[model samples]
Target chain A: MNRLLAATLLSLVSSPVLACDAVQLGTIEVEQAWSRASIGTSRPGVVYLTIRNAGTEDDALVSIDTPISGMPMLHETVVTDGIASMPHAMEVPVPADATVALEPGGYHGMLMDLTQVLKEGESFPVTLTFRNAGEVTVPVSVQGVGATDAGCSENNG
Target chain B: MRLTRLQKALWVAAGLAIVAFGVLVTIMNRAPEPAAQASFRPTFSLPDAEGRLRTAAEFEGKHLLVFFGFTNCPDVCPTTLSEVGQVMDDLGDEAEEVQPLFISIDPERDRELGLAEYTNAFHPAILGLAGDQAQTRAAADSFHIYYEREDTADASGEYSMSHSPALYLVGPEGDWLRQFTYGTPASDIVSDLQSRL
Candidate 1:
């Protein structure tokens, strides 16, 4: 019926809204988690998703943790020399009452040496530790093995 | 009628010029010129998901669409490969003429088995290429591609890469061809390949 009402209903059905009481800084929510399938002689894959910050104070995502791989790291994508080059994780600064997206062709998390192929219709837990806010566990949805788009036909796209 | 015969000639010339202008306009309304062809097709060797070595040179004399990215790349990597897959489908049998390559920038982890497995998830023709950093860098430089690592640290004291997203069109000669921007439709890629054929 209204904008607020619609946003509320959509969040409930799909993306779960996460905001904690202690930080007073903000809440970071992860959704639509996915990784590319292992390719040609390579066993490990990378994971991607959005880390939305919903709060009143500035939010900085310092690190990410996942058990599926030997190591979990955050990264940002850059293009140089007509190539895609990623160096390291950027301090994702989510402004007060705003959201920062971690989508395809951009910044995402790196999941290395996965225990197994992250299957679709299944989800895994990844704990994100914020500089100001403590650790928050988010269930990452393992998208289809063939899923290409970061997310099309959905808001993530 | 006071004018001379030469004056009459001048009036006819003016009329001819006016008609010629109209004809020029009609000619200008013809179809547009086709898109440009790729400069050259470049080739490199990288491991697959199963650790098998495949070379771009091996696919020579065939239409090839290769993209450079890493398996650790969750979003752009898959999207670009998927787009290449879509282009392959668009070509149907002609798609066989074009080979799709999924090259990884993150050679640190995208060894033989990882690369092969990652690429297999997409189209079979879509091969994944990976090598040691030294080899990968040489390949990247030859193709005029660029990539760098971002500083994303996890609990295990490690890093990740954040690189560019590029789709290179390598011709039969293993030279660099043209490229499509991100989000380009498969139909567009197919159309380009058709012209090359």
Candidate 2:
């Protein structure tokens, strides 16, 4: 019983810290990963994050994997002539020493076939694979429904 | 040439007739064109989330905020709805006089997915409307909204919908008032609505 209590306390104390910290692999830093609370299980969800490449070499986000979703894909919402179309992005190129922000009304990570409803204040782990930087898992916090931004300071890292 | 009294009276009548015809033509050209007005002033009859038949007449005396989108849309639709919610909140008590309707372009899937639940997550005041394919098409036609399903579908047979992203504002008299284009800030929309309301 004492061991179980200690494990529970440790999980509660470590979860938030893990979600708040930015993950760095090589020179690629992934931060401010967040998603809005889902309305229903049938519809898809989305994840927004910022990827900054500090190295002189350019990289690209090739793929994404998350246990919360069955099919995770990178999609871009293109608005042309007042029409909006969401197309599957083959890959998002991150230039050298530049930041690529996956935001609303632009590029975003589409979470298809959600296993469970994303509740507010919860966090999920998503493994983002880069062409050059390899793979790095980042914790994505679930914000309120219709949240525009992560609503947190970048200094949390 | 000297004219007789009868000829002089006939000449005066002809001049008066020409003047009257010129005045009539100018008035006709200056009058509002019904065809142009009718094109802009569109109406619709569809079923709401509660399955009740709702028409434009039902929203008489209140401004109608209409947007066309689908619940399956993960990005632009929700972002626009959130901005609409912000506008409503900024309106404060004046929001009561505004009715925001989210018309689903993908009605079949939206109905099964629970449209009300999806919209209420952004704003409870936003009413989600869906209809059969024919009815949905008719409503979209009236509003000049365009929507097309992509040929590509996921392994689960789910597809995405491409649609117009403009938010239309209808006056209390059921006339097209203004259009808030995609990405317009909520503050601008609130100020416009407040001035009109």
Candidate 3:
């Protein structure tokens, strides 16, 4: 019993650190935080991630903050009549026991006026605030310039 | 038992009618229904990524894949470009026969250098073309492509573009062959191109 308790405690403490892409705040779990690499001095780099809510209550992503960008805003790309339009979102909802994917051609967080170019194999930090879960910061890995799929299989947190 | 003369005549007539129906079906199957293609005037002379004036006549001997989007578009544009790159990759040496042309709708933001950067990120062989408002409008209008800037509410003054997400496939002589809708898998595109080749 004592050994089992120790193992559980160790897992609970080291889980977040072991999984660089996973962050937990209250019942909100953010995973596979990643962004695409950019060209020379390219501003307006977009960030993608998966937000999962495990709690019994609903939560909404209120805002996002990152020092690398001048303004981090929640945005979604809507394609209607074969025309794509991306508008600044007021908030993205994360309902209970549901998962929302911020992927290419869909919802993504825009880092407006990037201070530095995003390079491949590099990672940055981003803080996401939720209505109920408060806030959680996670490191976002920069994939290749044309990468679209999240490399979640490599690092499943 | 032998049939009577009247019964024999009826049976023969029925057999002939069945054979006629079979022939009609075969004829219908042999002639494939023509695909409805949107006709576009194959004409344009725009500056390529290297700032060299390129015309549709230059690519007369190869299949041209023309895509319209902006550099600021992070979603559909990149996704479609990546799919195009994958198609080229799967084509192997035959990719030389195909020219992927990316035409920017938002010429103000996507300058020559920016167009080069965006296209190079996908495939080196892809040509990124940008032009002034008049040139862009002519190119888009010639192809019947629709694109407009959506005024966003962000204080950063950043806006997104709404453009048709179809990839136009032109023949060697600048004839409209077919078009692929958005999110078409690379394998399907490769097969279509291969069949056409």
Candidate 4:
């Protein structure tokens, strides 16, 4: 390229307006992730994790990413009339500079199709990809054996 | 440090023997307990299938047989509900004294209409209880219930929850009574409930 063209390109690439901008990337903070102990039989499991807004801009959790399973979804567990129902949570709101928690029976990352049983004393990595917070991976701790009250003490029969 | 060839061979043989012994032991181990221990009854506050909040006090005057399940539950929930319904029917009027409550552990999708429709399939008066996380947990806690949300990928390209399958029996005062095995017969259950009653 000619000297004039090179100078112009350099000026554009190294523009002063593009330098020292903190608004380029949003910051995110993830809290501890844990789940009840895995049961021996084919029991259910839930993974709990917290996502904090560490930036000034508004953001939302568009989706969750997991490497251990084919698909990771967001779901809410509700009880109406006298039945327990679970429905998909298409999008979890993580307002600007706010935190959204994924806990039991709430907004949690529903890992579909476990490649392997979630055995006790063992943890596998799962990633949550947020709309603004990006993606963060965590090793969830499974709780409660075939136990229904997820975190409560066992009934010693 | 390197081990001698003989030492390596011995170690390998020992490892193989241990592996074989482990396999033998695993095979000898009997089947795991199908249901959780039901040493005591539990209390909870959840909405009935009609969408009305229900507390353990709703049946404080009589025995309560509570099971955590959902309307949409294909095999486990329906089976347990039907069996319990049978046990209730076998009890005749005594079954009236022993209130049978079906509390949905999968509350998110089990709304009032859904619960009513699903529960009515098994038997009338199989009261369904559905609550939010906090209310559901409290009720489950009283019963010492255990359940978790297992994610499943659906064909339509979404995920579903797989939860714990268990049943509980609370006393007249809403105290933890006992839990039944998944395949427990109605006869045995009626007998157990009669003894308690």
Per-model C-alpha lDDT, please?
0.65, 0.88, 0.82, 0.60
**Candidate maximizing DockQ:** 2
Tell me how each candidate scores on DockQ against the true complex. 0.36, 0.68, 0.45, 0.02
Question: If the candidates were sorted by their lDDT against the true structure, best first, what order would they fall in?
Answer: 2, 3, 1, 4
Candidate 2 has a TM-score of 0.85
Q: Which pairs clash (backbone N, Cα, C closer than 3 Å) in model 3?
A: none
Ranking by TM-score: 2, 3, 1, 4
Predicted candidate 4, C-alpha RMSD: 23.7
Q: State every prediction's TM-score relative to the real structure.
A: 0.63, 0.85, 0.81, 0.44
lDDT of each residue in B1-197, candidate 4, tens digit only:
89999999999999999999999887666345333343554667777765677777668888877777655443345446767767777898787788778777668767733766566656676787788888877776666556666554455533233444546677787666566656577788888988877
Please state the interface RMSD for every predicted structure, separated by commas: 3.4, 0.8, 1.6, 11.3
lDDT per residue for candidate 4 within A36-148, as digits (tens), equals 34322233345666667777877777776655556556666554432344677788877766777665445666655545666544445566677756766555544332222
| Per-structure clash totals for the candidates | 71, 0, 0, 46
Q: Write the per-residue lDDT of candidate 1 for residues A65-90, one digit (tens) a residue.
A: 87777766677666655455665675
| Higher-ranked by lDDT: 2 or 3 | 2
Candidates 1 and 3, the one with greater DockQ: 3
The TM-score obtained by model 1 is: 0.63
Deviation in Å, model 3, residue B107 alpha carbon: 1.3
Chain A TM-score of candidate 4 vs. true chain A? 0.64
Worst 10 residues of 1 chain A by lDDT: A16-25
- Put down candidate 2 lDDT per residue, B54-164, tens digits, no spaces: 999989999999999999888899899999999888899999999999999999889999988988988999999999989889988888778999856656666899999
- Report model 3's chain A TM-score: 0.84
What DockQ does model 3 achieve? Answer: 0.45
* DockQ result, candidate 4: 0.02
